[model samples]
Target: MSKTTIIDKEAARQIREGMKADCTKCFSLCCTALNIVASSDFSINKPAGTPCLNLQPNYSCQIHSQLRDKGFKGCTVFDCLGAGQVVSQVTFKGQSWRGNPEIGKKMFQVFPIMEQLHEMIAYVSEALSYEIPEDIADKLSIQLKKLQYLTELDADDLLALDLIMYRFSLNELLTIASNFVREKAISKLPGNRNIKDFDHARVDWIGKKLEGKDLRASDFRGAYLIASDMRNSDLREVNFIGADLRDVNLGGADLSTSMFLTQMQINSAKGNEMTRLPIYIQKPSHW
Candidate 1:
């Protein structure tokens, strides 16, 4: 196959949804700096900090299409917060990387911090709008502004940023963020809270981690589980209604006669013909 592949419009659109201009500033740097090891989803010979042989000059992937076949599943999981462009557009003024080894090294060092700032931005932005009480809105807003400032920094400024930036009295803001996550999601998720009022009769676990845990016959209704890992766990007849299960992992789990486990969910998760049928699943193709 060729060194690179073209990203289709659908892929580009999906990337753009989570990608903000500020966030993408970091991704470009990450792409250039980080080395991804070859695995089941990416090729077998690569390392961090070394540019991927498949990367085009403009930071686009060469073998974008055959990623899985090339063993680059890790690439799909990465979310750069526009750190690339930040380094390129803000720090170096776009005059150095290709010809200057010293500048290239500095850009590589900046990737991690910008990525962290971008992640914090996502969380802070989400918290700002999640039902925070009016009084605490100002507190959250202040913290949000601080975090936004952290995103615009060059490598040196980011490295020098102190922990004091996160030292804010955000008790109410935290609660609002937590509750928003809980109410919109199932009571049980990666970050679970066993509140007395939680109605476990029906729950969803989209993109959660219950790996090697006991959750047999759990009622799940109106859940949005996208990429949860339930490896080698108990799941006999678990109800699943209105769940957004995109790429859930149910390897070595059981779901016999599970009510409401839809075909889409079944196809998305792991299952075999010998695996207890979920009515919706016609024997899986891989297993």
Candidate 2:
């Protein structure tokens, strides 16, 4: 397998489009495959492989419109990144677990693996969206193809995948891309004297008040930012991969160019109409 494949802008866009969830094409896999713990996000505890009580026979959520109001905020935050549709339509050849009782267990098992592969693909696709160096773009394109190939594997092959190792390798590439963009953005900052002060990778900022700060191009990977007040922050070009954004305030913040920000992360946080998000991420309806 080649380690470098050039993906054009249109191809990259299509790859990203494929990663967005389309619930109409899915079999409500998340409702059945995931174990829900009773928390503020979920109204009740449901065992894995057991369909939620609100799941209709047609595989649609009975209370889809009222998920958040009904205390099913977790459901609203969950995104399969188009994994469910791929597993249902491609992997299993349009077979429904409900119709084919024998495939139910295996289908449930494959969904999560497919979700992870799709996620890696989505991130790599996003990295490729940026105007990075040629070497990094080639490497990201290669990783994107590799992850997409993994999603096409059989259920057993997906189950056998060493996701930890793949994630470790992919994270290195993503970090390199992130640093390149962040450094470039920081260099262009006016006065340009406080460059060394922006490195906040993996820091603890839980419940901290940081309202209206010029936080452009900061490295915040794996940071604990739960419940932080980050309203009106200039978050452009900042890296937020693996950052715990639950309950964080993003009201009036500009995250238009934030690196590796996912729909799930944005959905978990508190944001309003004024929060500027990346073009790919939709503002949460509840916001």
Top lDDT hit: 2
- What's the lDDT of the predicted structure labeled candidate 2? 0.87
Residue pairs in steric clash, candidate 2? none
Q: What TM-score do all the candidates reach, one by one? A: 0.56, 0.95
Candidate maximizing TM-score: 2
What TM-score does prediction 2 earn? 0.95
Kindly list the per-residue Cα lDDT of model 2 for residues 1-287, writing each as its tens digit: 34335887677866775578887888889999899999999999999888999999999888999999999999888878888999988888888889676788999999988988888888899888877788888888878878878888888898899999999889888988888888788779887455467878789999999999999999898899999999999999999988999999999999999988888999999999999998888998888
At residue 196, what lDDT does model 1 achieve? 31
The alpha-carbon RMSD values of the candidates against the true structure, listed in the order shown, are 12.8, 1.9
lDDT of each: 0.55, 0.87
Minimum summed lDDT over a 10-residue window in model 1 is located at: 1-10
Residue 143, candidate 1: Cα error in Å is 1.0
